[model samples]
Each structure stands twice: as structure tokens, then as C-alpha cells.
Target chain A: MKIHGSISKTASFRTTNAVFIGRSIRLSLRNAEALIMAIMLPVMLMLLFTYVFGGSIDPSGNYVNYVVPGIILLCAGFGSSSTGVDVAHDMTNGIIDRFRTMPIQSLSVVTGHVVASLARNLLATAVVIGVALLVGFRPSANALEWLAAIGVISLFILTITWLFAAIGLVAGSPSAASGYGFILLFLPYLSSAFVPTSSMPSWLQGVAEHQPITPVIETIRGLLTGTPIHDSAWWAVGWCALILLLAILWSIVSFNRKAGRR
Target chain B: MRGNVIEVKGLRKKFGHQIVLDGIDLAVPTGTVYALLGPNGAGKTTLINIMSTLVAPDEGSVKIAGYDIVTDKNMVKRSISLTGQFAAVDEMLTGEENLRMICRLSGLTVAESNVRTVELLQHFDLTAAARKSVKTYSGGMRRRLDIAISLVISRPVLFLDEPTTGLDTISRRALWKIIDQLKERGITVFLTTQYLEEADQLADIITVIDEGRVVATGTAKELKSRVGGEVIELFNDKDDLIRTVSTTGSIHDIRQKLNELASIVSPELRVNIRKPSMDDVFLALTAKEMERSLS
Candidate 1:
């Protein structure tokens, strides 16, 4: 075949990024084990918390509404960790080396994982929300409030997905990456995701109230229940932006260092 | 160097305290197959990596298709494609999808990418398995797909690092045929291999590296000549048929020795003279180096 004309840099860059994104999404979906991990925990936890502990935890008797926001945030956090495992697999499997040798944009590899993780997290969140709705969870959210909640949740997914993607690159193997996921999965447990922060001992309460996940969950709950977002929404946004910036910077640095070696 | 597609000067690299490639140099002319022959840990892959710009050299420079490896990396990338030791194919994707992804990444338009993907699948004899996931592919199919992906961009130079390391004989021959076709299309191929037969069969010029240094460089015949003169093979049921004889003198003296041997041994013995193969040359050169190092 003839050597066709070379594509312009901008066009090539966009096409490469699109191809990586599509490939990553397809691969992630086809990975049955990772898909089960991403979906199973959130569904199981929603059922357990709504049915087993609802009466004692929420004496006011609307625990489904109380736990749905928390479970959505938890699902997002857990779903994003799978991005780490996927990235680790890519790094160890020599595909990253192939990509590095190609003429495509370097950042597109990481960007593709980030975008795919976000898609996965959003899907998991929807699944949890659907289960919650089936279990009699209702929110008095208006269209604008629901839009705002989605924006906040999307930002949270973006931040956590990037953070774990970097963690995956630093990890030596896929199993090691899953080990790192434990920290992320357990963070929601200590946060206000399951119970109000004040119910904990004073020292634990401080951490549960102030960590990034708590404010994010609190903001989503307020947005859904028509409560004033107040400072918690801004704090959640700030945390997402700060974590995203740091994780992206770290991912680039680690990826370059790793890719430079033989 | 003027007509070379790949030129290297004093290239050096080391991993920590161990020297992998010690002040190596190479020059490959356009449209020729150049083979780098080495034993394991002789730094063949390191050299290929440096030339492909996958790993930077500790010292010296490389020019690919007239573009500096350090300063003109994008141009070097535009000119060369590397199929590494591992197949480097995405196991999760189907063979067709893998080719399509590479084509699109290489800047082909939608229709062009589709056509090129199909053409490459057919060329590599992977059309039947095109729809199957690479995870289910055999080692040979993965290797063919890897080379096919590298060819998606149609660069002037291609690097194959131990491309046939794990393939069966049939697959190895299939790959060699494909490589021959590439040469016919004027594509310069730079391959690193431990198989002496592979180098002898494919390379127009072969460089043998041992213990981080190039031990010898030349055509297969030239290398054999360096080790010694022509070998005489005598076939007989008796034990006295094998002999090593020098050929430093005139043809008259050689004829006299052959006649003398015929008179002494059985007249029924069959004698033939032939050049040494690459295996002999490689063993002789490496053994000499080993002895020198031990001393």
C-alpha cells in the first residue's frame, strides 16, 4: 500500500486520544472480574445498610434517603480503584512500552484511563441509585439540584480516579494496585457515609468530619434533600480540585520516570 | 554512512554497576536487512532500544533516517517502528481491533484505517483469526500481529527485537518470508537475534556482539573466513575420514596433499570441501573472546 499523506498534528492527537479512550472502555467492560468488583460491593452494602441497620441508625425512619448519597459516593470511590488495577496491568504487560514508542500524544494514555474510570464510576453510581429507588428511597430534588449533584459527583469521580491511576502506575503489579484500593474503600467507612460524624468518639469524629469524602457525601445529601449546600459544597469542590491537580502532576512524573527506564 | 538509514557512533549504556553496551557503533545502509547477533545478556535488546529511542543512551548519538535520535525524536519516531521481544499486542482486543487501533493511532483516516487494517490482516495471514481476541491467539499469531501493527505506519526503518525467539519452525519461516517481502518493498529492517541461522539467512550484514562488545562484523562468508579457510569433509565408514588441512599455498600443493591422502586412505572415501557455516564462525569468535577474557 502507498504511504498516505501524514495527518496534521492536531488531528492526529485528537484521533489517538479517541482511540485510546474507546479501547480502554471496551477492555474495561469486557473484564468480568473487575466489573464484578466494581458493582458487587456497592449493591451489597446498599442492601445491608438499608435493610439490616436502617431502624436503629435512622430512628426518624428514612434511612434509605440518608444512605443513598453515602453509598453513591462510596461506589464512586471503589469504582475508581479499578482504574489503578487496569493501569498496573498495562504497565507490566508491555503495552505501555508500545504506546511510548508510538508517535501519539503521551498523556493520552493516562487520560484514556481517567475518562474510562469516570464512565465506570458513573455507571456504578447509577446502579446504586436504581437499587436505592427500588428500596423506597426518595429525594425531593429539583432538576437544577439534581444537575448540581451530578456535577459534584462527577468532579469527585474525576479526582479519585486520577489519584488511583497514579497509584496504579507506582504499584508494581495488579494485585499490589488492588492492595492500594483497600485504603480508598475503607475511607468511606470512617467518613460520614455510613453514620453521622458526631456519633463517633471525639478524635474519630474530627477525621470523619474533615476528610474529603465526608464533605462530598454531605454536599450530595444536602443537594438531594433541598438543604442549603453552605460551605460544605465549596469545601468538597476545593478538595476535588486540589486532589485532582496533585494526582495528575504525580501521574505524569511517575509515568515519565517509569517509561524512561528499559 | 552517507547512504545509511541508521547510523550510530560510540553508543554506550549501563544498568547501575553493570555495563550493558560498551561503546558500540553501527551503520546500516538503506533497504538492507541488518542483523545484530548476540547471546543472552550481550545487550542486543539494549542496542535496539537505544536506536528505537525507547531508552536513551548513556553516551553517543544515533541518527535514524537522517534525524538525530535526541534532538529530532519525533522525526526518528516517524521513520521507525519497533516490534519488541514480547509481542506487545493488546491481549484484550481482537486481532482486527488491534490493527485498527494502531492504524488510527498512526494517523490514518477512518476509511484508510479500515482498508489498511484488512490489508495487513490478510498479508500476515491473520484474516481467519481477525475477529478473535489476542488472548486466545498462539505465540506465532501474536508475533505476526505485533509486526503487522508496527508496519501500520509504513516507516522506512523497522526494528524487530528477537521477533522469532519463541516461535515454532513453521512460524519462524512464515515471519522470515514476510520480512523478505518487506525488503522487496525497500523497507530497511534492523533485527536482533540469538539464532545464528536467522542472521545468516536474513542479514546482508551481520554484527556479532558478546559480553557488551561487538566481537565481529561482516557477511556470513567473510566471518567464516576470519575463523579459518575452507573445511574438507570426508565421508567413510572408517574413523579416519575427518581432517583439518591448511590452504595457505598454491592449488598445486593442495592437489598434491589431496592425492597423498587418497593414496594413504581407502580410495572409496568421499571427500568434499565447503565453507564453514555461521554456527562455526560464531562459536570460534565467541570461544576466542572467552579465552581472552579468562586470561
Candidate 2:
């Protein structure tokens, strides 16, 4: 019968991930509406914050620089939110059953969505960054700092995409997963995405300062525009690493619980 | 291809307070089409889900292609291809892309994957729609693609959980022809269906379950014989059945039924004798089981 492959262990892992990642990427490209929204919404937000709110927030004309990192994270958030819906659809739909019956690690299914989310957000972030430049946002960072900024942004996307995947696994339906996605999308607003933590109401300052989004955004902002890094990078990487670990664990547990596979 | 390809013992599953499969047992011989027939809510899907390693049975031992479904789940999975009740095909991808996806997952090389995808799409009669998104497919086309995806690799066993549910008669017959081919390839197919004709036409052995319990298991003829003998029928001028007297196919019983029919006979009336079909077998056995449980 020459059944399913006798591929070596490492080769099988590579093939499983490549196949699923390729599947997710193809579907993402096919979804023109979501792809447009992922890029357009963030660019529009950057414009709004830079022109409409930028004047009132920062009269000195460099408000674009202040808001670019935040907009970048928001773009990533939007991209990852779609991943949640995707993961939920796969989990709740009958297609996952087909995958579960195959001789491969099912974790690849969730990771594919996460990786695709990373790739998508990177493109969206690039679009947002380009718009930021056109709107007069200036950065003093050299190549090394630019690389660090991209590193932080990527880790953040991976973290949140896996988080959404966990939510998708736990949600009963795609709509429900998106409902939770909407709630998580507001994370950027509560952080230092658009405003300074010091300028916010004193009582609200603690949350704006302590949340995962704040540290990652501050780290990206610091790397890009020469703001004080001052251990924010450590917190940024630490928080992302911790949440990524937890999200992976949560997704694996829930998927195993649901599919009854290891 | 002689011994059992699938073996289940003491299979039990419960969801909350409802029992789905209760102490069920069955064996499917290699290279045969084994049909599970039951009414709605008979736990057929749950049983298939367990065998395909999509869900763990609360209590049972299931072995597929010599691998334990629980402990050696991967081996069991490698041996089975499942087309669930739903089409389960990716609507976003074209029919050819979906086939290629499964081929890649099955670990085929790039050249082999392309050739296999083209072969499967053409064989499934999906070549014309191969480049179109699956969302554009009709119900029958989607079902055909679903089964084609399952056939991307040669597994020893295939599980189809209500594969033809909601399909039109023509679509169902088309799927039946595909199942017949799978049988010819010596793949042990386990499918669940509520349609008695599907069971009768396709199954080498038909097992009927009712309310989480197996009420009967045998060849179609064996189960029909269990319903026992023929029926003497009386029809009116409108072809309406007037009365039916069941017989054990004995000469004395035939004479007795004929005598009974003579009393109600008239010039405008007609008489006929009919053999019990799988439908009769199903109705009689399910009803008898229900009655037994109620008592």
C-alpha cells in the first residue's frame, strides 16, 4: 500500500510545517478583503493620529514619529486578530478532523497561522512605516537599531498571534473568536501607542505603564526614535517570551484536549 | 486481507449525561465494505470519530490495521483516511490545490504531488472545476472532492461518517460507485448511514445500531431473513395495501394465509406476495429492540 510516508522524523516535521504554512499563506493571499483591511486600517490610523490627533497631541510636527511604533503594533494586532478567526474556524470546522487523522503533528496547524500572521503583519507594518515617512515622521536610528526594532516587532507579532490561536482553540465559533479578537485589539489604545504614559490620568498611569503592549511599544519606539531604552528592551523581550510560552502551552493543551492527540 | 482490519470491544462513550456508544463491539474484515446503519442520534459519528483518532473513547479498545487506536494513535492514523459528515474540503482553495495539499502532507515529492493531484482531480471528475475555487462547487462536486482528498494516499482503511447525508440520489449513486472502487482496491471501508438501500447495496456486512446499542449484525440477506419470511398482501383497486399476512415460507402457513385472504377477497381486489427488504429488516429489528427495552 505504501501508506503514509516513512519519511525520517526531521523530514516529517519539516514537511508538516511547510505544508500547513504553505496552506495558511495561500489562503491569506486568496482573502483579498482581509489582506486589504489589515494594511489599510493601520495606514488610516497612522494618518488619523498624525494629522488629526497629531496636531493636538504634539504641536511640534514630529507627532508622526511618536505614533509610528504604536501604529505598527496595532497593524500587527489587526493581522493577528484574523489569525484568531482562522484558528477558530479550523478548530470548529470539520477540516481539522481530516488533519487530525493524518500522521503528522497537529501543532503545525496552529503554528502555520501564527507564522502567516507574522509575515502578514510585517508587510502591513512596512506599509504603515512607509506612510509614517510620507507624513513627516523621522527616525534617527542606524541599521542596528532598525534591526532591533524589527526584532521587537516580530516577537510581538508572534506572541499575539499565538495568543489569538489559543483563544481560537478555546472559542466555540469563528464569530466568537473574533468577538474576543475585538477585545484584544483595544490593547494598543490602552498602552503608550498614541499618548505618553505621564500625560494619561495619574490613576490610569499604572496600567498603561505595566501592560505587555506598553513595554514592547516603548522598546520599539526607543529603538526607532532614540527614546530611552532603559531596561524597556529587557521587559519587552521578557514579556513577549513569557506570553509566547504560555500561549503555545495553552494552544497545545486545548488542541490536545479537543482533538485527543499529542 | 482475510482477518479483521478493524476490531472494537466494549466501546463506550458518554457526553454529559447522555450515553452515545454503550458497550458496543464489532469487527470489520479486511478488504470489505462495512456499513454502520442506524437512525439519528445512534452514535455512528462518535464511533467513527474514535476509530479515526479524532476523539478518544471513554471506554473501549479499538484497533485499526494492527495498531491500537489510543496507544499507537499515530500508526492508527496513518492507516486510516476519514471523510467526515461534512465536506471538510477547503473552500478557499481550488479543487486541484486541495488535492495537492493532501499529497504534500502525505509526503509526496514535488513532481509526484503534481501528478497525483492531476490524476485524482480527473478521476473524481473535478478536472473541469480544478482551477476554480471549491466555494464554486456544487454539493455533489464538493463531496467528490472531499473523497478524492481522502484518497490522496493509500491507507489500509477509510472511515466515512455519513458520507452521503443530504446528497441527491444521483450524487449518492456517484459516491457509491467510488466506494465500490475503494472496495476493489482492497481498502477496508467503514461508513455510517441511515439509508438502508446504501447499506444493502454497498455493505458486505451491515451492522444496525439503535440508541447506542447494536440490535443486529449480518449480511443484508441474513438481517432480512431475521425479519423472517414473506408477506401476503391484499391491494385495492387504487393500488392501496389493504392487509398483509406475514408467512414463514412454509406450505402450511401459505395455505393458512391464503385461507385468511380469501375471506376478504373480491373481484376488484388483487393479491400479491413480497419479500422482506433491508427496510423491513431495519424497521422490524429497531422496533423489536425498542419494545424489548421498554419492557
Candidate 3:
């Protein structure tokens, strides 16, 4: 079939992004099980930790203020991991093959998943924050601090989402992607998100204090409570930027490798 | 050759140590159905993938719509569409959404995309189920939707790799009708199938491949001729009356042979003669290749 006319060489960046993002969001919304896990798991954890162990864990009489940041980190971590599962599903289901053959931007597929995951995690974070407020959590931050907190969280979400999306592309199955999520979910627990790193055992404190999640949670915690904005915020930004850079490169290389193979 | 939409030369592909496509060559003219007939594991899909730019060939050159598949891939992609053996439609999206998404991705404006989506839904008889998610669609409906998605921006060439592999007879015939319409619209079709009957019914030209090699390439009739002419069967209860004769003669000659056999053997013997079909051609050609390879 010889088409007489040539296709426009101009790539439609907007249209391609819209198509992929719309598809990703629509598909994620339909997966009720994944949505419930991404949203409700953090809410349940918030309720359990605040009501059950709030007083014992934080005798400072302001447990909600401390635990809310931790729960928000938890929500972001768990929600980003779902991006991997979605990417894995797309890879194994042959949609990736279809996408590869199209004239659209090559990275739009991964970008779509990353953007949708950011939206989902932000929404989940909002819900967690709402629940925390309802449970008597209060922050001393001003409007700028709140905006900075959101900016920091969004960056963190973007970084982790890309990282896991890469992992999902490399994973053998959706179930395996979920298994990879457990590693992310466990990070906040080991970090200072849930408690002061000083409270951890002397042998374990070093790890708990230095991991990526620790600096991020501490930054969010400091932002929310009007604490001294110190090196933790810069460290968090650096980690996010580094992870995003690596993840983007890894994802592009892996995606090309996968698409290049028969 | 100037009007050919697909030109493949010495096309070769290897998976690890196994050569899946062994230096094959082909040319598909514009607005014709070129059927690739092969048994399972004959590397039909590998060939399609290389042409469609989904996989890279280890050796050889493929030019689709006058664009080299390796160096000018985007041009080749913009000029062709592929429907794989599996339905590649997104199951979570509605049938309409799927079509519109593909249209939008192809750079169609929203209004144009919507109009095209509706037109395709109606054309494929999917309008009734357009609002339902593809996960709810039957195999036939999904296959139609998958094809519909590929046609969102009708390119010059379409590659259908076993498009009706698992479809029922009715669905298969329906897909064939759609493909025929595509050819009528001046779209070049490159189809791969294991069904000899399908190739015979729809192909303007047929290429028979086996074990990663092209065994024969010609029209269905031309291929059938390669396997010899009509078959004559003589049957009877008496063992001596039975004869297996292969001849390329007229019905009159067949009747005369049966009459001569009847006089010599048993008058009760029955004779049946029929044209050699694509099935016979496929079997004969592939079997020949297998024998030659073994020897």
C-alpha cells in the first residue's frame, strides 16, 4: 500500500503526552485493588500508630506532628512502587511493543507512568495529611513552608517513581514489581521518619541516620514544624536529583534494550 | 519495483545461536495482499517485527514505503502499522478510548481524532460496544478493536502478523473482509498466517517459508502448480483394485484411466479427482525443504 502523501515530520509532543498520561491514569483508576492498597494502607498505618502507640512512642505530647511526616513518606514510598507494577504489566502485555512501533516520542510511555504516579502519590499524601489533621496533628509552618514541603515531596515522589518504574521494566512480572515495593516500604521504618534516629540502637543508628529517606523525612519534618532549615533540605534535594538522573538514564537504556530485543 | 511499498533484501535475524530469518528477500507492491505462509516457528513474526521496526535484524536491509528500516525508522513507522498475533489494545480503556488514543498519538487533532474514532467504530461494527472496556470484549471484538486501533491513521502499508490466529470462522471471515477493504483503499498488506485456506482466499501473492527460509514465492495457483496438478483417487473393497496415481491431466484422461482400471481390476471401484489445494502446496513445499535439509 503506497500512501501518496508523506506524514508530517513534526512530532506532536503535547498529543503524545496526553495520550499516554490519560491512558495511564485511566488504567490505574480502574485497578481498585492497587488504588486501595496505595491509599488505604497509609491511612490505616496512620490510625494505628497515632491512636495505639502515639503516647508511648512520643511522650513529648506532640506525637501527631512527628508521625504525620513519617506516614506521608510511607504513602509516597508505597504509592511510587505501584508504578513499577503498572510498567511491568505494560511490558509483559505487549503494549510496550505496540508503543515502540508508533511515531510518538520514545520516552513518552515511561514519562506517562512517572507523571501519573506523581499525581497518585500526591493525592494519597493529601489524604494522609487530611487524616492527620483530623487526628489532632498540627504544624507551625507558614504558607511558604507548606509550599516548600509540597515541592520537596513532589520531587521525592518523582525520583522514587522513576526509580521503581525502571525496576518494574526490568522485573519479570507485576508480582515481582510489588515485591520490589517492599524494599521501598521498609525504608521509612528504618529512617527517622517514624522516630528519632538517636533512639535507634548505636549499631543501627548510622544506617538509619544516613539513608536517603531519613534526610527527606527530616526535611519535611523541619519544614512542617518551623525548625531551623539546615543541610538536611539541601541533602534531600541532592539525593532526589541524583536518583532522578540515574533513574531516567537507566529507564531509557533499559527501555531501548527491551524494545530492541525480539 | 518503483511502486513496491515494501522491499526486503537478504533479510536475516538470529536469536543467540539460532537463525530465525535466513537471508530472505521479498517485495510487496502497492495495494496488494502479500501472504506469508509458514508453519509454526517458521520466523514469520520475526520478519514482521523487523519490518515494523519492533526488532532489529541481525543482517540484511528492509525498506518500507521507501524508507530504510534502520536509518529512517521514524519515516518507516509513520508509513506503516502493525497488528501482532496478540491483541495489543489496552484492556482497561473503552473501545472508543483506545481508538481515539491511537489517533491522538498519531498526531490527529482532537476533532479529527473523535470523528475518525467514531467512523472506525462504526466500520468495524464496534459502535455498540464502544463505551465498554476492552476487558469486557470478546475475542472477536477485541481483535476488531485492535485492528481498528492500527488503522487510526491509515498508513500506506499494514503488517498483520497472524491477525486471525484464534478467531472463529465467522470472525475470521469478517477480518478478511476488512483486510480486503484495506487493499481496496490502496493500502499494501503484508500478512503472515499458518492457514493455507486463508492465504488461498485472500492473498494476491503467496510466499511459503519453512525453517527460516523461503521455500517458494508465487500466486496460490502458481504454488499449487509447483506441487503438481490434480489428484486422482481410486477406491474399492478389493485390495488389488486400489491405486494411488498422481497425474497432471484433464478430467477426461482421469475418467479413461479409471475405466481402464475398472476393466482390469474391479468395476465396483470408485474414482475421485480434485484440484490440488494450497494445503497440498504448503505440505509438498515444506516437506521438500525438510527432506533437503535432512539429507
Candidate 4:
């Protein structure tokens, strides 16, 4: 057979990415239980906090509105964490070797999981928002402010999704990847997701006010509820940008190392 | 090494402190079936991985289809298909979907991908199970599907790493038939296996490796000849091998030995003449290596 000198042009970047993304989404759809659980866990948490603990946390019954943004962020966190498991599963399987021998960019598989996670989280966020409205949420934001809140939420989802993808590439197995991702999920609970940071112990308040998730949650709350954003928006964007950058770099390094060693 | 589809010179690789491939050199000619015959841990997989550009060699140059494996990796990838030891199929996707996925990844249009997928499913006898998930496939079906996936793009070279391993006899023969078909299509096949009968049946040239080194490389006939001449065996009524005697396989030598055995031993013993099979060659060659190393 006549072999050509240039054959890498056969697979374009767009088609390669499209194929992988379609695969990831199809796999997620087939695994309907995981998708439902991701949405259900955060929705269940929103209900628990608004009805069960809202009275003790706040005398007024405005807890639904107060907790919706946190639930959205938590919804995103829950959905994106599966990226770790998916990526780890792919890495540990035989298919990666087939992908490596192909004429396309191998890491498109990782990109597929990240994009799928982002898509799944957005859907879960919408569901959680709908549930919050059905209960008692009444945000005062107009269309532009709502758009801003969505941008922040999507940014947060993208950031953590990439971080989780990196964790998947670094982890030895799917279980280990989820274990690492689970520890980071605590960031949402420790932030101003459920209660005011001031009510926290002075020592704990230092952590609540300073961590990355708090600023992001504060920014979304400000845009949605007309609360003063102060410099939290800038801090939120800055922290997400930094983490996104590090996570991407970490993913590349870990992927290359594992690919070579395997 | 002339007009070879795959060429390697002094290829070396190591994982941590363990050396997997030690200065190995090989050449696989175009439109031929070459077999790498060795036992487990013989570095057969490592060599395939390095040639396929999945792993880098520390000290070697590999050229596949006239493209450097390291410098022009994508070009090399475009010229080859690797069906690994374990079936590398996605268990979650249906057989048809998995085939289409590779077709699309290989730059086929959606229409072309669909046609190709349908053709492959029928060709590999997977049409009835086309819509079923691959997780439910039998071992032979998965292996056939894995090979079918490799053929989606029509490259010049195919690498089968122990293709018949873990397969039943019927599946193994079915795969051998497929290999014969691939040969008729003039696809250069590089397969690795520990089965001497497989190498004997399928390969045009066989290279035997032991402990990360090439111990022998020749045609099946040449390897059998290397084990000396025919062997004479004596068995008792229970059909157990009593003893074997080496021979030059001449008519006179055989007659004299059989007469002497009949006179000194019992006539009730069965006498059988055996030609040197691939098994004898493999054992003799490997034993020689062991002796050399021990000394």
C-alpha cells in the first residue's frame, strides 16, 4: 500500500472533539442513575436547609431565596465531581491505548469529560433553580443581573470541573479520584452557602470568609439579591482564573506522565 | 531489511530499573506476516508499544511505512492499526456505534461512517448483535470486533498482540482464518504469540525473543532444522513416553536402532518416529540460551 507522508490532516480538531464529546454525553445519558443522583442530592440538601433548618438559622422565612444560589453552586459541585470518576475510568481502561495510537489528539478524551460535566451541571443547576422557585424563592434581579449570576455560576462550574478532571487523570482509579474530589466538595458547605459567615466561630470564620468558594457564592448572591458585591467579584474571577489555569496545567502534566509510563 | 514496512535499529527501553527491551533490532517486510514468538515477560508488548509510538524508546530509531515513529508519529499512526492483547473495545457502546465512532474519528463523513459501520458489522458477522452493548459480547466476538474496528480506515500495517490468547480452539482457528484473509489482501501483519503452532501456521517469518533479547529469527522450516534431525521415541503398553533417542533420521540408522531396541528391550513396546516440531525447536533454542547464561 502507498503510505502518504502527511496523514494527520485527516482528523480536524473540531471533528475529533465532537466525536469524543458525543461519546461522553452518550455514556452519561446511558447512566441515568448517576445524573439523577447528582441533581437529587443538591435538591434534597436545598429542601432540608430551607424547611428544616431555616427557622433556627434565620427568623424570617426568606431562607429559600437565601439558599438558592448556594444550592445552584452545590448542584454544580455535585455534577462536576463525576468528571473525576469518568476520566479515571477511561484512563484505567484499555480504550485509552487505542486512542493513543490513533491519528487524533489523545487528550480530546479529557476535553470530552470536561465539556460533558459542564453541560450536566448546567442542567442540574436549572433543575435546582426550578425546584427553589416551586418552593418559595423570589430573586429581585432583572435580566442583566440574572445573566451575570449565570456567568459566575458557569465560570465556577467550569473551574471545578477542570480541577476534577485533573484529579481524575492523577488518580490511580475511579474510586481514588472520587475520594479526592469528595474532600474538595466540602468547600461549598464551609462557605457562606447555608449561613452568614459572621455567625461562624472566629477561627472558623477566617476560613469561611477567605476560601475560594465563599467569594464565588458571595458574588452570585450579590448579583441575584442586590447584596453589595464589594471586591468579591474581582476576587471570585481571579481565584477561578488561577485555579483553572493550574488545573489545566496539572491535567497536561499528569496526562503526559501517565501516557508515557503506561 | 530492504523495502520493510517496519524497521527498528538498536531499540532499547526500560521501566524503572527493569530492562524490558535490550538493544533489539527488527525488520518486517511489506505484505508479509511476521510473528514475534516468546513466552510471557519476553517484552513483546513493549516492542509493539514503542513501534506504535505509545512509549518512547531510550536508544533506537523506528521507521514505519517510511515515516519516523518518533518524529512523524501521526503519519506512522495513519499507516498502522493495533489490536492489543486485551480487546480494546468500549463496553458501554453498541457494536455498531463503536464501529461508527472509529470511522468518524478517522475522518469519515456521517453518511460514510454509517455505511462503513453497517458493512463492517455484516462482514465480521456481528450484524445480529449490532445494537447490543459490547459488554455482553463473548470473548471471540469482542476480539473480532476489536480487529474489525482496526480495519475501518484501511491502513497498510496491522499489529495483533497475542490475538488468539485466551481464546478457545474454535475461536483461535477462526482468527487464523481471518489472518489468512488479511494476508490475501496484502496487509503486513505483525503478531506476537507464545503459541508455536500459531506461529507455524500463520507467519511467513518468526522471531523468537526470550528475556528481552532476540534469540532467533528465521522461517519455520529454518527453525525446525536448527533443532537437528528427527527424533526416535519408545513407549510402553500404557502409551507413556519411556525414553527418546536422537537420530540422523537415515534409513540404516533407524533400522539398526529399532533392531537393537527390539532385541535388548521388549517387543511389546511401541516405537514411533517423530519429526522435529516447532515445540522441539523452541525448547532447544530456549534451553541453549539458559545454558549460555548459566555458564
User: What are the root-mean-square deviations of the candidates from the true structure over C-alphas?
Assistant: 3.6, 2.4, 3.2, 2.6
- What's the residue-level lDDT of B68 in candidate 1? 91
| Per-residue accuracy of model 2 over A154-210 as CA lDDT, tens digit each | 999999999999999989889999998899999899999999999999878999999
10 residues in a row with least lDDT, candidate 1 chain A: A2-11
Candidate 4 falls in which docking quality class? acceptable
- lDDT (Cα, tens digit) per residue for candidate 3, span B1-295: 2488899999889888998999899989888999999999999999998899988888899998899999999998888888887888888889999888887787777787788888888888999999998899999999999888887777888889898888999999999998998988888889999999999999999999998999999998898887666766777765443665555777677667777777787667777777788877887788789899899
The CAPRI category of model 1 is acceptable
Q: List the residue pairs that clash in candidate 3.
A: A1-B187, A1-B188
Clashing pairs in 1: none
TM-score (C-alpha) between model 4 and the true structure: 0.95
Candidate 1's DockQ: 0.41
Chain B TM-score (each prediction, in order): 0.88, 0.95, 0.91, 0.94
lDDT accuracy of residue B56 in candidate 3: 86
lDDT of 4 by residue, B1-295 (tens): 2489999999898899999998898989998999999988989999999888888889989999899999999899998888987788998999999999988888888997888888888888899999999999999999989999988877888999999989999989989998898888778999999999999999999999987889999999998888767777899999999877656688888888888888888888898898889888888888888898799
Native-referenced Cα lDDT, model 4: 0.89
Candidate achieving higher lDDT, 3 or 4: 4
For candidate 1, the per-residue lDDT at B72 reads 87
Candidate 2, residue A177: lDDT? 92
* Candidate 3 lDDT by residue in tens digits, A25-44: 88778887887888999999
DockQ of each: 0.41, 0.50, 0.45, 0.49
- Which candidate has the highest DockQ of all? 2
